[model samples]
Target: MMRFIKPFIMPAVALAAWGTALPASAQDKGPIRIGVPTAIQLQIGRDTQTGVRMAIDEINAKGGVLGRKLEMVVADETENPEQGIAAIKKLTADEKVDVMIGGYTSGVTLAQLPHIARSKTIYMEVGAASPAITQRVKSDYDNYKYIFRSFPINAAHQARGLVDFISGMLKDEMKIQNIAIVGENAKWVQDLVPILKKGATEAGANVKLSEFFDTSTSDFSPLLAKVKDSGAQYLIVILSHASSDIFVKQWYDARFPIPIGGIDVKGQDQDFFSRVGGKAISETVGNFAVRAPLTAKTLPFWDAFVKAAGTAPVYTGVGGYDAVHIYAEAVERAKSLEPDAVIKELEKTDYTGVAGKMVFDETHDVKAGPGFVNLLFAQWQADGKREVVWPKQIATGKMIPPPWMQVQ
Candidate 1:
């Protein structure tokens, strides 16, 4: 009787101590924590967080993944790289999150990668399009096993599409000869220049001038003067949300008559266009993820997002929404909380998400399908509505340049 009682009593005591040490872990067996590092102050950041929240709510409402309720731990990165890294560290180490989703800027995303790898936690990049994220995967595949990006690679698909569309429109429609590539000197656009140049040459368009301005450049008069003197018929402007608005306004103020067009134009939110005003923004053509008309393929996502968020949908919002759903799908496929299993599931996915048919290539980069679904050209009309002008299949209206930009 004493021998039997001793063995049973010792095992019971050890179980009681373990349970007391981790009480919460014992009680709630079905709550997976997801860490979100948001740039709450930024427009795109706000929209992205909103989208992610909407997805989480919907998923929870419909019986969450792996029979567990989903929970989010949100931290503000403040649109700074250092802050982003700190936020990620806090989330991964302190909170012990199963996964992470958020990143508006390329620099922030790049800075957070090492920390994510070290922790061996899954990070789904929602909006950062820097090619380095995916391109590096091919060279250092092991380091990127935990990182997956939902947005199209920066300037690869879109830049190629823009060059082809612009050149065809110039030769067959606008009949222009020379073009200029202008962008802010940031990693986002610098990596794009070479790709744009290659595509432009293939399209038989002469790139007469390729200029890069500092992100801090407030005065564009000097740059506009150089562009005007270069005799370039088309201006391809590529800059981030804030700087793009500044450049457009300054280009108008300087009375630079070149027909401006580029990748950074249409993907931004309505606030960006409003900041420059309808009149000032009118007839400014640029390429974006989806055409301005919002086709059958895109309208459902736009509608669902607007309904969920109670606001107009933007590109970043779309990206965030897709990121959440994509991550959930990967988790379900992996059927485990481990990052390595989820990475393999993500690599094998061919999901048709809000951004279009998303298939993760060998390098962990999603291949956004062909044509306008992946990118589209749009022009800001006088009616405060941006119209799709290129990729005739989805064009809501024809290409119409501004009064100041009509062919000479």
Candidate 2:
């Protein structure tokens, strides 16, 4: 079911029939092609691909959806918005994929939206946290109804979760008063920092130092020194794959007394400890898009994923796996591969996969509030292990602060 192909392998010919749904009679003829146009050059991309494959294999093993094999056609977008647009175009117009799943960066996802709308490809965005993707669906449901987001909470909602945890739990328990914010100067984090700062301020913490560095940055001494000098007790780092190892290593090397936290995507990797010594990332708190052991289905999936991929799945990988199943369930419910029929069935989704209960709201995004798919928080302990530590209902353990960050 998971078939890998080269980019642009599918030729584009028909134009006017792009947006129209496939005829019902023609739907049961062949495999269900699910195109994945993503930054396949990166680790995150590979992780996502692994998850997608795992899901596809499992589904196909179970006789697949609508009694047809689910095939995955992956394209390397090279982390470029223009490349993403081109890749999606090839996927929809050429490969004629029944649906599309993938997007690690927000900017690239936003760039591909117009093409997705034009082609009427059912796009389940597994990554990319920018709220605009779903907001656009809300604004023009008739046009953007084909779009859906399975992972990556919106910026504002992510901010609220970080604020609530820090203010309601960390601040009181650790006696935290001042904090600093540090992130890469990407569009997603650029949009997220202000929201984080405002939330931190509202939660009774003074923003000591707020800074953004280029993704290419390797030295974090300047930023770490500023945080130490500013008397900040916590450093909220907003970063992804780029510069995460450098930032963590430099932070540990500098012996900066402040505890690190925030949207640490890289820290979610199973190789984090090996990349930057176990002691280095210990006690570092951050949020992940999805963490295993959250529900009854998560652990089994994670174990199988690790056995197949030779590594534990990351947040993006979890998202990719879930997205495939989500699409399969929709197709099963619709009883047709027609784009319109599947889209309608998708709108009525109340399914739960490895990620969480995925029920699309009016905006075609996963609902995230009380009694919904809550964001996951975790902390790396000194034992070189990580565990879920928030949303009391699903927490695997209580958040523990490093001795340095604890009240004296």
Candidate 3:
């Protein structure tokens, strides 16, 4: 009695399907082909893929979803949007993947959305943070039924959490009247500034300079000099894994001394810290999704992930892992892999995941609450531990602002 919504051919489907024939056995076989774009090149992507692999292994080890073995066809998007769309087309058209997962960059994810909807296959967004994904879904409900996201929207919630942490740490602790916001000039970050600004103002922090740079920019001296002269007590740094490492190192070399904190710090995975060296990460504060004191629900996932990845799990891994489980649970709930049914089941999901609880809102976005607000501010201590310093309830340690942040 299972039913499926037929695929709607969008303009790109024809463009993508040229010279390619659809798989014949795709309708009869139960093998779920999952298309994953290349995110493994970066720390976040690597961690995400590791988590996904672990989840798939676990699922397969146990009895696979919908009585079908899960197979993932990973394509290297190489951080290109067009390439990502091509990958989706190949997976959906030639490979006939039932679902698609993996898109680290918002741009890549945005570009692939049209193709995903057209194919009528489920697309579980694991790592992209652009709010537009879910917002568009809400706005265009009928057109975007097959899309679902599993990551935090933008830096808004985390940014607000960072501001609250800074305010508490300052406590008249310092005359931190001015602040600077620096992020990669991407759609996600561009959309996040206003949210960050509102949160900073609520915390009594002034936005002195808001700047954006290309993700490929290696040198940050010019930006650092501007920040140092801005009279800002704190700097909010938001960039991807590679650019963030470069900025942190350049900022340290410049000896600007202002306490810098923001997204892309802990979110990039521990490899980022290791790449920058422990000394560089010390005394820094930023928002992170998964931190220590793993809850009962997340501990098993952590253990499995570490064992599979051969390293500690990062925040991005948690999202990727949870996305798989959430998708599987939805598949089971619907007892079918039909896109619409799976989406309906996804909306009803209330499972407790590593990130906390997973439940999709009307826009197929995870509802905001403990799971959504898991964003915590932490400082890297001397003992090589990044201790939580904000939201008193879960904080494991105190906030230690650097000397530059202290008012002379």
Candidate 1, residues 1-408: lDDT per residue as tens digits?
000101011111001010112234432676788777877676666677766766676666556677676777777787688998998999999999988887777888888888888988888877677788776678777876888777654557667767767677675677887898888777777778888888888888888899888878888888888888888888888877446666777776666777777766333566556777654454444544443334333555565555555556656676676777778877777767677788888888765555467777776776754722376667776656777777677778776666665545
**TM-scores for every predicted model:** 0.87, 0.88, 0.85
For candidate 2, the TM-score is 0.88
lDDT of 2 at 29: 88
Deviating ranges (above 4 Å) for candidate 3 = 1-28, 170-175, 265-267, 283-288, 370-373, 403-408
Better of 1 and 3 by TM-score: 1
lDDT of 2: 0.75
The per-model lDDT (C-alpha) reads 0.69, 0.75, 0.68
Report the error of model 3 at residue 292, Å: 2.7
Runs off by more than 4 Å, candidate 2? 1-28, 283-285, 289-292, 397-408
lDDT of 3: 0.68
Better of 1 and 2 by TM-score: 2
* Model 2 Cα lDDT, one tens digit per residue, 119-180: 98899987788888889998998889999998766776777777877786567666787888
| Alpha carbon deviation, residue 40, candidate 1 (Å) | 1.7
For model 1, give the RMSD to the true fold.
11.1
